[model samples]
Target chain A: MLLQIIVNGILKGGLYALMALGMSLIWGVMDIINIAHGAFIMLGAYCTYWLFNLWGVDPFISLFLSIIFMFIIGYGIQRYLINLVIRATIFITLILAFGIEIFINNLALVMWTADVRKVQVPYGASNFSIGCVTIPYVRLGAFFIALVIALVFYFVLNKTRTGRSIRATAQDLDAARLVGVDVAKTYALTFGMGVGAAGAAGTLWAVLFPINPMMGGILTLKSFVVVIIGGLGTMFGPIIGGLTLGVAEALGSNWFGTTYENFISFTILVLVLIFLPKGILGKSE
Target chain B: MAQRGATTKKLILGILIIAGIAIPFFSGNFIIRFFTNTLMFAVLASAWNIIGGYTGYASFGNVVFLGIGAYVSAVLMEKGGVPFWLAFPASGFGAAIFAVLIGLPVLRLKGHYFAIATLGVAEAMKALVDNLEITEGNSGIYLPMMNLSVKAQYIFFYFMMMGVLTLTLVVTYIMLKKKLGYGLIAIREDEEAANSLGVNATLFKVTSFALSGFFSGLAGSLYAFQQGFIKPESVFDVGVTVKMIVMAVFGGIGSLLGPLLGALSIEVISEILTNYFLVAHTLFFGAIVILAIVFTPKGIMDIISGRKKFGINYLLQNIRDHRV
Candidate 1:
């Protein structure tokens, strides 16, 4: 039972951590919380759903189109609306994020109404059984993709020059200016990258969960919880945080009968704020 | 006897209070009920300002304390068969303890994390309350009351809201007098600098959060008492949280009159529009919030204080950084 639960949690956590990675990137490097991160994910899921249903596109093939579509939207949004307040206070940025979130939700309600959409791929729910544990294929595939993304992000930030400039600007824009990097482009790129990650997570989420306009609210909260527990800006923090949170939630529901499951993350969030302000890992990178 | 500005403020407040108290008399039963809901929301918005505006913590979880207060009052009144007056304080007690417990951790995280933590706590509380048997679960619980009337409820609820708003302003005035309030402002401006300057950032934040929680709980109890109904969805609501934060931000964070002015004026406008246009009220309010943030990032106080400089400065700043 323990092994099965642990495995289930790890699979879910990997995907959640990937979502957290997108959130953490915008927060850590871009210095904007991007409250609309989950909305972008919702949009991506819808995009994937339509492509799979209408165009005979597989989930994996449609992932590329979703990324491309989201990248343009993300870049345009950041360059136009978000950059206006890059020099403003964090409060302004927060409001901007919220304003956009409300706008998107309302727009989506007008366009699509409040219906739930499902993305049913071939054998979407197929699972393998081993020693009394069931592992779903789609969940496993999502986890594999999340791992791949994290590894690629790790390599880009660790070894590349543009990544170096992003790191430099995140640390200190003034210092980065002296070192000759386009801070504006870097910020936009970081935001685009964050949204791209959101797209990937949305595809995964579309496979397992139902999608709606306001679905972003809960995912946004989950990402924050994952980000907080993992610590800000830490590449591997989301992976650790996501797994811990997923398992703890699973355990909480098991022990306290699901009523306390939501409370567990919050209780842990409160504890993290009080005792582990720097996050559980005490590392950002 | 005519103290001019003071008398003017007192006159406006008196008229607003009278109008609020006389709401059920002027409108239909449904309108009366809706106005009551708006007034309840106003009280919540004002209570939120005590900590959010003053301390700058951006607590996205203020609804949790509201839930605590509502649950406490409802449980005591319905389950324990306590009177309205006594049950109200029971609500406060629950909120106070919850605020302290949750605030201890959430208040420590800075910036976005603090906001997210509060939101998580709020959402978590809702889910927890939803499944708890004591609160009657997702099906909801009905209040056992002794003749609850909409008119009588409005009169008392008016006083409740007016009283909390007055208390908030008075407490704010008192805090701003000495070094304690200044300590909070210092932390808001720069936490590390404030700490270096001998301000105990932790204590101040935790205390302010508790104070905010206490009053929000008070408002919640008043809400439950007035409605004779309490539910986890409305009590610990995300929409309520957003409204509070938006109200504070729209008026002028860090100012006493700002939140009150913002809540009352915005709500009054919403009420008026809803009276005439009904369904358009939500979309209109949404637009107002967006416009408020875009045009006046510093809020109404900033516009009022620096009316002459608004446009010129906006243009100047944009021109100076033409990278736009």
Candidate 2:
């Protein structure tokens, strides 16, 4: 039973890492919280849902399209709306993100009434047994996909010129500007990249869990927990944070019941803020 | 000249107070209900201004106090047979106690961390409330129905809420003019500097948070009594936080009249939008907030008070300052 719970947690953590990656990246690069992130994830889920329901496009195949589409939307939002208040006070930027979140969430509600949806496929229920342990195929597949994406994202960040520019901008905006970097463009790009990741996570989530327009709130909170736990800016932070949270949540639910999942996550967040404000892997200023 | 100006201001204030007191007599039941709700929003927004605007903590979980207040009053009235008058202030005390405890640790966090931590706490509180037996769990608690007629009930709650609003405004006005207010403003401008100046930053922040919680809790209690029902979702809704924040930001942050004007105007706009668009009301509200934040971060109060000259140039200057 313990092994089963651990395995389940690790798999769930994989998806959590993906969701947190974008949020942490945006925060690291632009200092914006992007409160509407979960809404973008919701939009991605709908995209996959519609693709599967209307045209029989597999969720795995539609993930690419959703990422691209969400990237554009995210880029546009940062460039046009968020950029206007990016240099304002922390309160202003935070409130602006919140406004966008409300807009997207309500727009979703109007476009598609509050109905829970999920994608169904032939192998969605299939599982493989190794010894006494049972591994679900869908979750295992999602886990592998999430791992590959994380690795790819890390490689791009470390190996590419654009990635270097993004890192430079994250570290020092004025310095990057002195080096002829378009800080504004980099911010927009970083935001778009983060949203694209959220889109990918949403596509996977649609296959594994029930979804609706309002599903973003808890997911957004969960991502924050992961980001805070994993430490900001570091590539491996989200992965570590996500795994810790997933295991903690799994154990918490097992012992305390499902209602306490939020309780457990929030407790960890508060404790981390109080005891380890810089996060586990975050470098002290 | 200054004395005459003060007298004229006092005269205007006196007239406004008389009109506010007599509003229920002349207004219809619907209008009374509307004003009561708006005044409650005003109280909440003003309370938020204490911590969020003045202290710069920007807490997103203040609705937790509202939830606590509602539950405390509801539980008292339902299980203990306490009267509404006693239950209301008791609820405020309950929230104040919780705020002091929670504020001690979380208030140490700065900037976005503090904001997110507060939000996380609020979500945790909601979940905890959902499972607790004393709050009746998810099924929620229903207060005993009042024996008064519908009009009387409306008028009673209206007056109760108005009284709460008056108390909140008076307290805030006095605080803003006193040492505590200056300390809070200094902390917002620079916490370390405030501390260096012997402002007792932590004490001021916690006190502001507690005061904010106190009024929010009272509003919640009044809300519970008016509705005759209390649920975790209704009282602890994030939407309540959003509305309070938006209204506070819309009118002006940290000013006495900002939240009052914000709450009244936003509520009016919300009512009008809800009537016409129904499903699209939230969308419009969100759009308006975004536009307002982008174009006028200082809020409408700045223009009304003539702190910033109102014209097309003002809008252009805002865009130039913020735009990349």
Candidate 3:
């Protein structure tokens, strides 16, 4: 039973890691907390749901479509709206993200209503057992996809020219601008890419669980916990943070009931903020 | 010229106060109730101003204090048979105590970390309240209905909320006018400099936090009594915190009159929008928030006070100043 719980937690953590990576990237690079990160995730899930439900397109296939669509929207938002406040106090940017979240959430509610949705493939419920462990295909597929995406993201950041420019902009805005990097365009691109990751995660999420407009609020909070735990800026931070939170939440829910599960992450967040502001893997100041 | 300008400012303020005081008598029940609700939020936003505006800590969890106040008062009245008058102030004290206990560690965090930590604490408190038996868990506690006419009851609660608003404004005014107020703003401007100048940052922060808590608690108590229902979710709702912050930011952070104006305007607009837009009102509200933040980052108070010019040029200037 313990082994199964751990397995479930690890599987659950993978999706969380995927979600956190986007938020962490945006925060690490832009120094702005995108409070609307989960709203973008919600939008991606909706995209996947519509493509699957209407056209019978598989969620995995629709993932690319969702990412492309979300990238455009994300890019536009940053270019037109968020860019206006990026250079102000961090508080202004935070609140700007909040306004965008409120906008998207309410718009979703108006368009889609508050109904819950899920993507059900033929083998959604099918599971395989091996040596006293059971693995669901959806969960497994989602985990590996998340892992691959994180790996690819890390590699692109380290190896690619665009990645180098992003890193440069994140490090020093003036220096990057002096080098003809077009800091505004880079910020918008970074935001778009970060949100594209959210879209990908959301596509997988829709396959595994229910989706709704209100789902973003809790997901956003959970993503924050994951990012804070894993440490911001570092490549593997979300994976570590997500897994830690997943296991802690799983154990906490099992022992104290599901109502207390939320407390575990929040408690960890407070403790981390107070005791280890840099996080386990974050750089020391 | 300076003396005449000060006299005119004071005269306008005096007239505004008198008009506000006499409003309840002239207004009907619906308007009074609406005004009361706005006043309650004004108190909350004012409390937020003490820490968020003056001291530069953007707390996203002041609702926790509101929740604490509501639960404390409701429990006292329901279980201990305390009167509403006693329970109200008791709630404020309860929230203040909780703030002191948590503020010691939380105040040490700066910027976004501090904001998120307070948010975590608020959520944790809500979860804790959801589990505890004394608070009756999620089923919530209902107060005994007051034996008074409905109109009388509305009038009474209106006065109660008005009194709370007055207390908040007076406290905020004193905090800003006194040396302690300067210390708060000094810390906001540069905490390191404030510390170098021998301003005890930690104590002042905690004190401001507790003061913020006290008003939130008082507002919560009044809210519970006005509604006669106390749910952990309703009292500790994140929406309340969002509204307070939005109003404070909308009006003008770090100003005494800012929260009051912000609260009144937003509340009135929302009330009117609810009648027309129904479900879409919040969407429009969100859009307005974005536009407001983008165009008037400093706030409407700046324009009203002549610190910022009112025109397309002002908006363009704000965009230019803040854009990448």
Candidate 4:
């Protein structure tokens, strides 16, 4: 039983890592918490849902489309809306992101209503067993896909010129400017990349769970817990954080029932903030 | 000339207070209820100003206090058979005590960490209330309706909320002029410097939080009594916190009059939109928040106080200063 639960948690944790990666990247690069991170995820889910329902596109295939769509949206938001207050106090940026969240959520509500949706892929129920441990095929596929994307993200950040420029801008905006980097464009591109990751995560999430316009709020908070647990400024932080949270939450729900799930996540967040303010792997300033 | 300006300000304030007190006498029930709601938000924004604006600790979960106060007042009146008058103050104290307990450890963190911690606290509190038996779990609690006419009840709640608003404003006004206020401002400007100057940062922060809790709790208590029903979702809604933050920021973060102006204007705008646009009100509200933050990040108080010029140049300057 314990092994099965751990397996389940690890599977879920992979996607959680994908979810937090976008938020962590945005926070690390811009020093702004994108409160709309989950909303972007929701949009991605709807995007996948529609493509699958309207044209019978597989979720896996539509994932790339969602990324492209959401990247443009994220890039535009940062360029026009968020860039306007990028240098203000954290509170202003936070509030601005919150406004964006509200706008997107309501817009989605108007467009699609609050009905929960699911991606009914053909292999959704298929599972495999290994030594009394059962794993859903879709889940395993999602896990592999998530890891692959995360690996690609890592490669992009470490091995590319754009990644270098983004890192330089995050490190020192003025120095990057002096080095002929277009700081504004880099910021926008970084935001776009972060949101594209969110879009990819959302497509995977739609296959695993029900999708709705209001699903983003809790996901956003959950990503926060994951990011904070894993620590920031490191590539593998979201992975570590997501696994820890998923395992802990699975254990907690097993012991205390599913009703205590939210409480457990939030308690862990507070405890982490109090005990490990820099997060598990975060470097001290 | 400065003294004359002060007197003029005082005259305007007096007249406004008088008009506020006389509002219910002539206004219809809907208008009276609207004003009461506006006053409640004003109190919330102003209370938030004490910690977020002046002390520079932006609390994202202040609705926890509101939820606590509502539950406390509800349980006292419905289960314990306590009078509203007694239950009201008890609710305030209960929330204040909770603030101190939570604020001690939570306030140790700074900036976004503190804000997120507070948000977690609010969520945790809501979950707790959702599961707890004494609060009746998620089924919610309903208070005994006041045995009075509809008009009388509306008027009564209006006065109650108005009285709380008056108390909040007076307390804030006095606090901002005293040692506590100066200490908090010093902390806001530079916490490390304030600590080095023997400002007792923790005490001031906790005290500010407690005071903020006190007023917000009172507002929640009045809200519970006015509505006659309380639920975890209704009282502890994060939307309330968002509204408070938006109002406080819209008017001005650190000023005494900013939240009041913000609440009044935002509420009025919201009311108008709700009446006319109905389904799109929230969308418009969100758009307004975005525009307000982008254009006037310093807030309307900046323009009113003449700290910023009201022109396209000022708007462009703000964007230039803040944008990448």
What DockQ does every candidate get? 0.41, 0.76, 0.82, 0.86
lDDT of 1 by residue, B1-324 (tens): 224545655666688667766765677766666655665565566667766777777787888888889888888888898988798777777787888887875676777767877887788788878888889987777776556465666555666765766666677678778676898888878889999999988888887787788778888887777767777888888878887778777777886666666776677777786788654456566666756665566666555554345576764454344332
**Alpha-carbon deviation at B269 in model 1, angstroms:** 5.6
**Winning model by DockQ:** 4
Error of 4 at A162 (Å): 1.2
Q: Write the per-residue lDDT of candidate 3 for residues A86-193, one digit (tens) a residue.
A: 898866887788889999999999999999988889989999998788999889999999999899889989999888999999999999999999888989988998
**Candidate 1's iRMSD:** 3.4
**Lowest lDDT 10-residue stretch of candidate 3 chain A:** A89-98
- How much is the lDDT of residue B216 in candidate 3? 93
Tell how far residue B32 is off in model 4, in angstroms.
1.4
The superposed Cα distance between candidate 4 and the true structure at residue B188, in angstroms, equals: 0.7
Each candidate's fnat, listed in order, reads 0.37, 0.76, 0.74, 0.77
- TM-score of each model, in listed order: 0.90, 0.97, 0.97, 0.98
Cand. 1 Cα-lDDT: 0.77
DockQ score, prediction 2: 0.76
The iRMS of model 4 comes to 0.7
Candidate 1 lDDT for residue B110: 74
Residue-wise lDDT of candidate 3 within B87-142, one digit each (tens)? 99999999999999999999999888888889899988888898889999999999
Which is superior by DockQ, 2 or 3? 3
Which candidate, 1 or 3, would have the higher lDDT against the true structure? Answer: 3
Model no. 3, DockQ = 0.82
- Give the TM-score comparing model 3 with the true structure, all chains together: 0.97
Q: For model 1, how does the per-residue alpha-carbon lDDT over A166-239 read when each residue is reduced to its tens digit?
A: 89988988899888898878888888888988888888888888888788877877788788888876789888
How accurate locally is residue A223 in candidate 3, as Cα lDDT from 0 to 100?
A: 91
